[model samples]
Target: MLHYLLTLAIFFAFFAVEAWGLNLQFGLTGILDFTYITFVAIGAYFAGVAAMTPSTNGGMGGSYIFGWQLPFPLSPVIGGIAAAMLGVVVGIIGLRRLRSDYLAIVTVSVGQIVWMVIGNATPLFNGWDGIVGVPQPYNSVMNLSTNNYEWPFLGISVIVAAIIFWLVRSLTESPYGRILRAIREDENVAAALGKNVFRYRMSAFVIGAFIAGISGALQIEYIGAWNPSGWTTLETFIVWAAMLVGGRGNNRGMLLGAFLVPVLFTEATRWITIPAHPLLMEAIRGMAIGLLMVLAVRFRPQGVIPERKRVFPLTTIPGLKEDVANGHTAQG
Candidate 1:
């Protein structure tokens, strides 16, 4: 029971990271990135291959290209970089002039394309079988039982999640974040105010991809394997649901939604000892999640924790107070 709870805790942390990234893109920047999980898959595959030694013909596991035998921190970092690179490519292609809904379609297309390619390309990530036996971080030196090792790994996961949360929060509260919000609300107005709409949107997209990549790396490390089956368009929808339920444009809301949707609504379903077909059970779970999303949208469109408006005092503008005191008002 304790181990099960620990597992849920780890999932909460991972979902928090992924949901935060989605919030930055969909919630703040107004980018409908339906291909977000592709980046996660890229990260997971890269991390898995990086940690494993090169596969040979006689090897028991599947074959993969890179087996860098890298340590923990470096593997996840590389995974993040790879995901960001993919983001740059996609953002350049779709974010140039595509509207939100249109961009979403493009993302879905791109996601399917990537998924198909990865699923067929055997040499890349072992095709449908996927890569397995990914080594955990610090397991060699720790030399603890699998159960005991999870404790330290859980600590590492929490630390990484916390760091991501802090970094994302700081970015969202910064001027850059405000500009993204401005672009989200009205791009034409933001452009008229001399903001480079494309640049800001691209930055947000890439940054979000990086965070998703990190989350994927952590997930692969925990599960010790990854395949195309694990990352589908459905995963993207789950992240979107989290942002919607928690409140878009609010980091705290992302965290809360992450816990509620993924950990509570999704994971809680597993405890029910149902006597049904696996496929039927999976369908039931999906229906439950869908129902929750519909109810949330119907009742609380703004989410459980609505995003707070950023208000600045007029006095904050330089020389505005002095001009007012001198009874001098400039005309446009």
Candidate 2:
């Protein structure tokens, strides 16, 4: 039971990180990034390749690049950088002029392209079989039992989640966050106000991708392996659903949704005995999630925890008091 609880905690940590990233993109900046999982895959593959011993070094049989066999801690950082670079490329191509439905289609197409490339290109991280045998951080130094090591790793995961939460909360409460909200509400108005809308959107995309990459690295480290099968486009939707159910713009809500949707809902499905084919069970799961999404949209569109309204001070502008006293409304 203790071990199970620890594992669940680790999973929650990873989901929290992913949800935070998605909240930044979809909730805060309104990117609607349907291909978000691609960045996570990038991080996982990059970190896996970095940590794995090269075939040239008589390690494994897979052909891949830069098998430096670097330390585990460095893998996530490098992976994050790689994912950020990809985010830039993606943003340049997708966010140039596309909006709404078109933007979503392009992002999904990009995700498909990435998935095909990784699944088919055997030279790159062993293709569909994916990378394996990723080492844990400080494994050698710790030299502890497997169960003992997991506890410390769980602690690390929790710490990382908290730090990410703090960083994202700070970003969302800053002036930049306000600009993002403005852009989300009305891009034209933000642009007319001399805000570089595209730049801000791209920055948000890249930052979110970086966070996703970090979570991906952490995920691969925990699992000790990664394959193409694990990062399908549907994974992106799962995170999106969590955001919707949790309260899009609320960080705490996102955290709760992460646990509720992915952790609890998924785990609950495991115990049910569906008297149907295995494939039917999968279909049932999808249908259940779809129904939940529909209910969320129809009844509680603002999510379980709605975003709080920001209160601006009446004296935000100088001389507003005198204008109000004279029964005159300020004009924009």
Best by lDDT: 1
Q: Model 1, 1-332: lDDT tens per residue?
A: 88888989999988999999889898899999988899888988898899888888336887898899999999999899989999998888889874777678878888999899888988888888888899989897888887787799899999999899998899999999999999999999999999999889899999999999999999999899998888876677778788899999999999899999888988766877557665777677777777777888899988999998888765788868977777676552
Q: Judge candidate 1 against the unseen true structure and give its global Cα lDDT, from 0 to 1.
A: 0.88
Over 164-265, each residue of candidate 2 has an lDDT whose tens digit, in order, gives 899899999999999988889999999999999999999999999998998998998888888889987668877888889999988999899999987888
Q: Model 1: residues >4 Å from true position, as ranges?
A: 311-332
lDDT (C-alpha) at residue 140 in model 2 = 71
Q: Please list the residue runs of candidate 2 whose C-alpha ends up more than 4 Å from where it truly belongs after superposition.
A: 56-61, 271-276, 312-332
TM-score of the candidate numbered 2? 0.90
lDDT of 2 at 102: 62
